[model samples]
Target: MTPRHDENTVFMTEQEAERIRNTVKIRLQRCSELAGHARETRDSKDAIRQATGASLMADMGAADPDSAQTKTQRGTLPVIAVGQPYPPCMLPLRDLQPMKLSNLRMDTHHRGRRLAVKRASPVVTLVARSWTMVFDEEEGGEIERLEVCLHKTRHGQDILESASVFVIKEPYFTLTDQGEATLRIDHPSDLVVCQDETANDILASLNEAKDDVDGVTAAAEKFARACKDHGNAALEKQNLPLAHAKYTEGLKVARQNIVSKSNPDLARDLSRNRAHVNLLLNQLDEAKADAKASLTGRQDQRSRELDSKAYFRAGCAAYNLGAYQEAKAFFEEQRKLTPGNEAASAYLRKIETRLHEQENGAFNFQKIRAGLSRSRPRADAASFVGGTEVRESRLPGRGRGRGLFATRDVAAGEVVLCEKAFCVVWGHEMEALTAMTYDVRDGGIRASPVGLTRSVVQKLLGNPSQVKRVMDLYGDYQGGGNDNVPTKMRPAEEEGPVVVDVFRVHGIVSRNAFGPGGDENGVGSSSSASAGLWVRAAYANHSCVPNAEKEYAGDLLVLRATQPIAAGDEILHAYHDGSSGDYSARRRALMTTWGFECDCALCAAEAADDPAVLKRRKELAEEADAFVGREHWAGAKRVAVARAKRLARDIEGTYDGERYEGLPRLAARTILEWLALAGQRR
Candidate 1:
C-alpha cells in the first residue's frame, strides 16, 4: 500500500547529495513562508498548532507522531506557547438590521497610539452580511435575526438564517443566538411582507437618491435611466465634474441593478464602475462591497486583477476605520499583486508610516484632520464643485443671496468658504429655550429609528468632544445667571438638545449625517421644529443650479461653490440621497423639504433628458465601435527624456505636469527602440 524509495537510492554520491540539499532547501523555504504568515497574523501557539494540524491532516492522516521530524514532514509544525488569549479587541454589536459594526475609527497619521481598554476575551459582533433575509422551503420564507462574526459574507448570512448559534475562533467563546438573535415566527404573517407598491416606492426612492439625491427616486418598477446614461458616458469626459456626474449615474444604476439582476457579469461591471462612483461620492464601504462583488462575478484572470483592487479597497476601509493591522495585511497583499503600481505603493507606504505612528502613540487628531482638510480650493461662490447650487440662508436676514454660493467660477474639489461653528447668541442676553419639555402617552408608539436616535444621543453625551462643545456653548450664553442651565445634562435629558459643526452636508438643513462621520446630529430637536438645528453645513438646499457644498475641517465649516453665478440663480444643495431612504419617502416622512420652488435642473433639461437622447446615446456608442479599434505595442522600450518650455496657467487641470511631461518622452523612446529592432531584423 506504501511506495518508498530503495535504501540504495535514498543515499547518493556527494555531487548528487549537493543537488538533493538544494532541492530540500526549497521545501524549507515553503515551511518558512507558512510559519511566517502565522507569526504575522498574531496567531497564538494554539492557532498555529491548529493550522499545522490541519495541514498535517491533509499531508498525512491526522495521526499522532512523537518524533519532531516526522510531525513536521506531515505538516504538524510546532508553535511557541502563548499565554492568555489576546484581550478581546471587540465590542457587542447592536441587534439591528444593516448592523453597525463596533469598530474604533481612528487616525493613523496622528502621532499617538490609539489608547483603548480591551474587554476580556469572548467578545461578540453581529455580522453585517446577515442583514439580508433568506427564503426557506419547509419553513416557507423567513427573515433571519442572528449575529455572527462582525464581517460575515452573504453566504454566511444565508447560513445564519437557520442556525441558532455560531462562534469565532472556536473554544474561546460562542455567540448564543437563541434569545434575541433568532426570533421564531409562527406564521407567514409574522414576517414583514410589504405590498407591491410600498416595495416599489421604497426601491425607487433608494435607487434615485443613491448619490446626489435627485427626484429620480420615485419609481421602482421603472429603472432610473439618468444614472445609466451617466454610466455609459462617464469615461468619455474631459471635465472632472462632468465625469463625476456620469459616475454618479453609474453608481445609481449599479446599486439598483444589484437587487434585480439578470446577468451577473453586467452587474459585476456595473458594480466595479460603482466603486469608482463611491470613491467620487466618498461612500467607501459601498465602494468596497461593489468591488468585491465585481470580482466574484467575473472570469478568473479579471477576478485576480479585480481582487487586487478589492484588497486595495479593503485597505482603504481599514485605514479609514483605524484598523492598522488589517490595513497592513491588505496593503501587503496589494503590493504582492502589483509590485510596481505607484498608487498602491504610495498608499501602502503611507499606511505603513501611519502604523508606525499608531504603535508609537503619535496619533495626532489635528494633524490628521489638517491633512484630511487638504482639498482643492474653488474661487467661485455661486456653485458647488460640480457646479450645483448648494446653499441655504446665510446670517438669518442678510437675505438668501448673502449665503454660501459664489459670484464667480470655481473648479472641482475646491474649498469655497470656512466659518467657525458655535451656538452664537448676540449680546449675551434674551430668554433662550434652555429646556423644552413635551409629554407623550405611555402606550404611544416609538419607532426603532427614533429609538436609535435616542440611544445615539445618550452615547454622544459621554463623548469628550460633545462634552467640550456643550460647555463652550454654555459659557457663551451665560444662561442669564440661571442655575437652571446645568453644566452637565441630566442623564434623563441626555437626548434633549446639542450643537454640532456640519460640513459639506447635502440636502435639507434639519436632517443630520450619521454613522461614520464624526459630526452627525442626534437627539437634538426643537418643536415648531424651528427647522430643528441647522448646521451652516446643512443650511443649504436643493436647486437645479447648486452653488456651493458644505464641508468641514474640525469645528470649522466651509461652503465651496464651483460655477459662476449671475445675480439671481436660486442657490441650492441636493438633499443627500438615502438621507431619508429616497425622494417620495423623504417628502412623506420629512415635514419640510426646501431649496427649489419646484423645478430643478434635471426637471427642466429637454434635450439630454429626452427619450431620443437615450436611443441616440446607444447609437452613438455603437458608432464608436467602428470609429475606434486597438493599436499595437511590440518589442522593448527605452524611454526618451526631454524638457518642455514653461506654459501659462490655463488651469483646466493637469497631473502635476510630471505625468504629462513624462509621457511624450517615454513614447518617443519606445518608438525609437522599436525602429532599431526593425533595422536589426533587416
Candidate 2:
C-alpha cells in the first residue's frame, strides 16, 4: 500500500522520486556486495555484525551503507539489526541526548554522572531522615524510577513542595548495583522548575488576590520595614553594597505601598533613610534626588523629623556638588526644622563664609582645601598599597610611550597602587545597548568606532573632568581634524572647532583600559569581567616577565608587587595570561593585541633559543599528562611542581629577580591537594 503524504509535506516530481529510488537501489546493491564479501572471507562475529547492520540500514533507507560504518564508529548512528525494531527503552530521549537517565544501569560503572532531564513529574515524599523526589517521565511510559535525594533545608523544603514539574540540568546521577538510580543536586540553580501555563495561571490568581488595596498596603509596609531593618544591619556591618541594596529594596516597597494609598509617611521615611545611605556611599546626586523626593507632598508634624534629616542630607549633597546657594537654602530649612541644631548651624556659617569669600576678589586656597578635607572621609594610611609617589619616564626601545617607575623601595606582595576606575561599562544589556565591539575572549567592551563614540558621549555627560583624564592616556590618534568625532557627538557650542576629544578618548581607552578584574573575592565569571579605565594602572608598562600583578576589588584596581621591587626598578605587570603559553606565543599575542613586540627578559631568552628550556618544558608537560592518564596523582604532582619551579627559576635567572612567583605557589598547592586525595584513597 502507498503511504499518504501530509498537506504540509512537499510533493516530489517523478524525476526527483525516480532519482532517489535509483540512489537507494545503488546503496542496497553496494550493501549486498559487502555482505557477500563478508561471508566469502568468513569474517569474525564483530565484523559480520557491522556488515549486517550497514546492509540493514541501507535497505531500510536509514543511511548510506558506505557511510554507515563511519557513522557507527563515531557513535553518530547506532548499529542495529536490519529488520529489528528499536527497543523503546533504548530510543533516544528528547532533550536528554548525550547522556540519558535510563542508560544509568547498575551493572555499568560510569565515571561521570552528569545527566540532563528532558521532562519530569517530580513527586516529592518525606521519607524518614530525608526527603526524596521521584522524577518520572511525563507520559509515565517507562518506569525507570529516577530518585533525587534532597537535604533538609528551608529552601530545599520549599522547592520540594513547589516544584511539581522540573527540568534537572546537569544533575549528578548514580546507579546502585540493584539498578536503583539516585540523582543529587549540589546547587539550587541546577534544578529548573518548568512552570507551564497552569502554573502561571495559578500564580496570576494568587497575585490578583493579594492586589487588594488593604492587602497590598499591609504587605508592602511589612516588606519595607523588614528591608529597612536588614539595611540597618548591613550598615552596622560596614557592607556598603549590601546596605545600599537593602535600602533600595525598602524604597521600592515603600513606593509600592504609596501607590496603594497605604502610608505616605512610611514612604517618606524610607526615602529619607535611603538618602542617608546614598550620602554615605558618596552618591551626592542620588542622595539629593532622594532627599527631595522624600519631602515632595509632606507637611505634617509627624513627618517633621524625617523632613529635618532629608533637608540636612540634601544640603550636604548640594554643598559637595558646589551648589552653594541651594545648599545654603536647604541648610537654613534644616536648622529651622530642628531649632538649636549645632551641625546645621555650623554648615550654614561655613556656607556663608564660602559665599563671602567667592564674592571677594581673593580666594583662600588653604581654607577651601581644609574645608574639603574635613568633609571627605580619609583613607587609612597603613592600608595604602603602592606609595603615593610614582614617577613616569620615557623608556626608549621599550615602546613609544612612558613607563611608570617606583620612587621608593616596594616590598614583595605590597600594593604599589590602588585607584578606582574612572569609568566602567559592564553587564550584557549595557554592553549590547552601547555601540561597542566587545572582546570575545573576556566579554569586555572594546573600543569600536561606534562603541567608543557612545562611551565618550556618556563620559562627557557624566563629568568633563573624567573625560579629560581618560583623554590624557596614551592614544594612537594623532592630532587630527574635527571630522574624527561624529557630528551628533559634537558639542553645539565649543571654543575650538576640534571635536577630536571622542576619538582621542576612544583611542586611549582602547590602548590602556584594564580588562575587568575578578570580583572582590578574586573569583571571576563571565558577568564579572568588565572593561574599566584606571589612569594610574594604565601607566605601568606591559611585560611578559612582570614584577607586579593587578588585582581587582570592585571598581578599584590594586597593583601588587609579585616580588620585591627595587626603589628605581620599573613597575611592570602582565597584560595577558602570561603563565599559560611559551615566550613565542606571548610575544605574538602582545604584538597582535597591543601593537608592540615584547622584548621582556623571558621573551628575549626564548627568542635566542636558550638550550633545553623549551625542550624541558615539553618533557615536563608530557610527564604530567602521562602520570595523570595513569591515575598516578603523586607522579603528576611531582612533575607539575618541578615544571613550575623550573619556570620560576628560569625567569629569576634571566631577569636577575624573582618573577612568576604565583606559578610555583599554585603548583605546590596542587601537590598538597594530590597528597590529600592519595591519603583519602589509602
Best of the candidates, lDDT: 2
Model 1, position 632: C-alpha lDDT score? 20
Candidate 2 wrongly placed segments (more than 4 Å)? 1-391, 394-396, 432-457, 479-500, 519-529, 610-682
Whole-model lDDT, model 2:
0.48
Instruction: List CA RMSD, all candidates.
Output: 32.8, 22.9
**TM-score of each candidate?**
0.24, 0.38
The TM-score of predicted model 2 comes to 0.38
**Candidate 1: stretches off by over 4 Å:** 1-229, 232-262, 297-299, 362-682
Where's the lowest-lDDT run of ten residues in candidate 2?
A: 79-88
What is candidate 1's TM-score against the reference? 0.24
- Writing each residue's lDDT as its tens digit, candidate 2 over 447-473 gives 222232334434443233233445556
RMSD of 1: 32.8
For model 1, residues 545-575, the per-residue Cα lDDT tens digits are 3555554433334455545444334345545
